[model samples]
Target: MAAYGYFLSCEEFSPSQLLEQARMAEQAGFEALAISDHFHPWNDEQGQSAFVWSMIGALSQVTSLPVTTLVTCPTVRLHPAINAQAAATSAVLTDGRFRFGIGTGEALNEHILGDAWPEASQRMDMLEEAVQVIRELLTGEQVTHHGPHYTVQNARIYTLPEQPVPIYVSGFGPQAAALAGRIGDGFVTMTPDADLIGRFRSAGGGGKPVIGGLKVCWDTDRDRAVKTVHRLWPNEQLPGELAQVLPTPRHFEQAAELVTEEMVRKATTCGDDPDEHITAVRAYTDAGFDEVYVNQIGADQRQFFDFYRTRVLPDLPRSR
Candidate 1:
């Protein structure tokens, strides 16, 4: 059975807009929520990046739906212990409704401190160690660690939820999928790829939840929607490790010039067609994802919610 959720993209929307979307998502029958964590926007036009922890605190007061960080990077930009503290407090505020989703992260956000970015292999090692540090601290015990990537001397997180927060690990490759399976409470990935999910299950993620998400545009004019996506999310089509290595929004913008509108049209579902939106969601449900989150890429979110609430959402089976 797959549960549908809404993705609140912090990279694109302001804090106030995200809050409104959270409220609307619940009103539209979304079962849960997932928010992205980024210190910088993918590009300037996407134009906003609020502190995820602060936004999570505010979200608790406004929405009863469970919230998860679509993925935060605890290995860099911030220490795992500090992230653990934030996650602990968020879990408390949400009354045990918080799930901490994390990943190895990209250089675009993690390199801002001028720390030499580690290659993917080393980053994965750091992430695995970070996950251990976060898990230990969430137990409300004093933690003293001297690891290769991080260290904590007598650190403790006092506030926590009644139940331990579930840590979902994000992956886009086979190695990452295996690591997530071996170490994560759950798995997170963007696509509805059954092969990737199969690898995770074989590596020990069988009974654990697998979460996924995508972005779409909803407008009466399909060409306008395509143009909106091309303008705001051209980076989505950048191939290979370009997304992982690009150092800044400017680099992203420059690289994104290679992404074409037709590419976006083929890759994204646009316009106000409920059937198109329904098919996009079914791709994930038909795969083995336990939950799927969807994001409306540009403005016109109110209409997107109304369309889903009245047509698309209700028509899709809640459980697959």
Candidate 2:
């Protein structure tokens, strides 16, 4: 059976709301959580971007469900060594129920430091080196290295869990997936693309956990739910690599203007039909994702959880 998780949208909720949601999620029977990490929301309409590390620290205190950064970018903004320290401390705080999920990152968050965004290829290279640095530091051993994309000098993570934290790498394409296979303890992506998961396994990631997530609005008024997601998450419909390269929330707003209501309807599952929610989430399990996270796109989180606990989770099958 695939474990179902609640996805905390840091871009759309305040820290307090997130904590409460975490408690409600566990009460609803979700076994884990995946939270977005961003310096800014996709647009001004979404209106919140609490620091993920701080939210995680708060989550550790009140929730028992395991938490993971849906995908933090350790390649830029924060050095990998610093991220390793934060992650180690988070695992300690969470009683070793934390998993580290990381990606190359977006220009919107990383560019705030005045660094030029590297091409996707170079970012992949940087992610590899950064993961290596983090793995070394998580061992609680001092590490020194100078690689193509990063450098470390006797950096070590002092606050560590009993076991080294599992690092999951995120990738949307084959090249990155293969890298995730070779270096990551696990793999993460957003879609139900079995081929990508197969590629990861063929390249050496067999038997490791695969985490995937999708967005859904669980309101009874279907049209209003669509409007809510359209207003707050038009960025979801952007094609190609726009979500990764857009430099600011305003740029995202401008680009997202081109996203139509119809596209949002086609991309997200909106409404209260438990059957539709079951079908929507089942795709991830069918695609071989070991865990699936559902992000409630609007503020009606408690309603969504109540619905899932009663109507949705029963219909979904678990693979683990």
Candidate 1: segments with Cα more than 4 A from true spot: none
User: What TM-scores do the predictions have?
Assistant: 0.99, 0.98
**What tens digits encode model 2's per-residue C-alpha lDDT throughout 112-179?**
98999999999998998998898889889889989887889877777789999999999999998999
Local accuracy of candidate 1 as per-residue lDDT tens digits, 57-112? 99999999999998999998999999999999999999999999999999999999
Which 10 consecutive positions of candidate 1 have the poorest summed lDDT?
A: 311-320
Candidate 2: regions farther than 4 A off: none
Give the number of the best model, judged by lDDT: 1
lDDT of 2 at 174: 98
Steric clash pairs (candidate 2): 1-318, 1-319, 1-320, 2-318, 2-319
